[model samples]
Target: MNVLEIRNLTKKFGDFIAVDNMNLSVREGEIFGFLGANGAGKSTTINMISSLLRITKGEIELLGRNIVKESKFAKMNIGIVPQDLAIYEEMSAYENVSFFAGLYGLRGSLLKERTVEALDFVGLGDKHKALPKSFSGGMKRRLNIACAIAHRPKLIIMDEPTVGIDPQSRNYILNSVRMLNRMGCSIIYTSHYMEEVEEICTRIAIVDHGKIIAEGTKEQLKSIITDTKEIWIGVKKEDALDLEALKRISGIISVRLEEQTIKIVSKAEINNLNWIIQQLIKDQVEISSVEEQAPNLETVFLTLTGRNLRD
Candidate 1:
């Protein structure tokens, strides 16, 4: 079953088109990663789906209900964790959860139970009475998530929930997301951090300039690029290596020397490292370290957009 369906979705700001005739479907119980560079219309598209922004020309359906026509019903079933912190600093964690839960019509014992459950799920059960201002960056992020899931909505949309936080907090957020998905909640995740998307998303869609340039599983997306393997070899300062000889290797496409490091780009099937090591041994080139760069979502994004994610 398709939990969300967007057809010919277009949103414009005067002469600039934010989302142009976009169409995509997210399956039920699947973690869909919505990826793009900054200002790529990722937030705009998500805002529209969450009913926080109006569509200029198109149709959006949530769980088989049209967003424009049945907005109240659609909005009620979806949870949103915006990119920025949505909690009040003066309010305690318990109070924050209670407030958002109340918006969903939860009350009395039911509301209290759900609030505690959400706090515990994010590993902040002991800090229920603590105010947001007292929490660390990561803790505050967890509280943001707790408030969003207090209602247990069928679909959860998280936009860069782990940005600008310590590794411990990032891991906490990632684990909580996994736990939620295991409990059968569908998620639409948007982030410039390719590693996070690669870690949790079952399916990914890369959007650029208000359009989806590519969409697939991690392996499937990597397969789109022919050069899948990247080799980095650190050379000692004293090695009298012949650059021309290294370039003569059959599978080796290009070689560049940066300081004491040498980078080799090649096709995915080529075991260029083994051959390079053998040749280095034969030529008496001093090899300090040889590491192969694994194919990642970041590489795919760079190849597709011709720019870095943070750029």
Candidate 2:
């Protein structure tokens, strides 16, 4: 079943269109990875879907209800964990989760039970009375998650839930996402950490300039760069090579210098390594080693959006 549907979704800030006309459908019981660079329309789209921001144009359906018109109903079925910490510093862990759960119409005995379940699920049951001000970065992130999931919404939108936390905390949150999905909650997960997305997402959609540039499984996305073998060459730090001239070579799609290393991104089927070597020798460049490499998600992101670093 499609848990969420977005058709022609767009958001604009006066003359600047943050999110162009976009469409996407997320399936039930799947971890959907939403990836993009800073100001790439990722947050804009997310805000619209969560009904936190008004859409200039487009349609969003969550669990069979229109989110714009039926805002309250649709929101009751959705949970949002913002990138910033939403928990209060003075509140105890139990108080934090209970407080957020109460805002969702949960109350009395039920709210109390759900709070305990959420805290325990996040491995913070033992620290229920501890204030968030005393928690570590990872623990605080976990508490942020516990608060978001206390309502057991059908779909959870997590934005950089593991940012700035230790690896152990990151792993715990990733596992918690999987656990939620197993319990029948669909997830929209966004992170700058590509490997975490690759590890957990059943499907992925990458956005740029407010449009979905690519959507598919990890292997499917990598297939877009067919027969593209990255060639790496190491040379002396003082070696001077003509970058523009190298880029002009046939089958050499891109050439750039990373420190003392010259990296060439080219198609393996048509790239002539021998000719490249000949040109290098003529240029009086000392060669250390030449290696062929396969493309990964990072390379694909750089190829599409030109921003490899996650914001």
What TM-score does structure 1 among the candidates reach?
Answer: 0.83
Number of clashing residue pairs, candidate 2: 0
Which residue pairs clash in candidate 2?
A: none
lDDT of model 1 at residue 48?
Answer: 97
Best by lDDT: 2
C-alpha positional error of residue 221 in candidate 2 after TM-score superposition, expressed in Å: 1.2
Clashes of 1: 0
lDDT of 1 by residue, 83-130 (tens): 999999999999999999999999999999999999999989999999
Candidate 2 Cα misplacement greater than 4 A, ranges: 232-250, 254-264, 272-290, 309-311
Give the distance in Å from residue 73's predicted Cα in candidate 1 to where it truly belongs: 1.0
TM-score of each: 0.83, 0.89
Q: Model 2, poorest ten-residue lDDT window? A: 302-311
Question: Which structure among the candidates has the greatest TM-score?
Answer: 2
Residue range 1-85, candidate 2, lDDT tens digits: 8999999988889999999999999999999999999999999988998888998998999987899889988888998999999
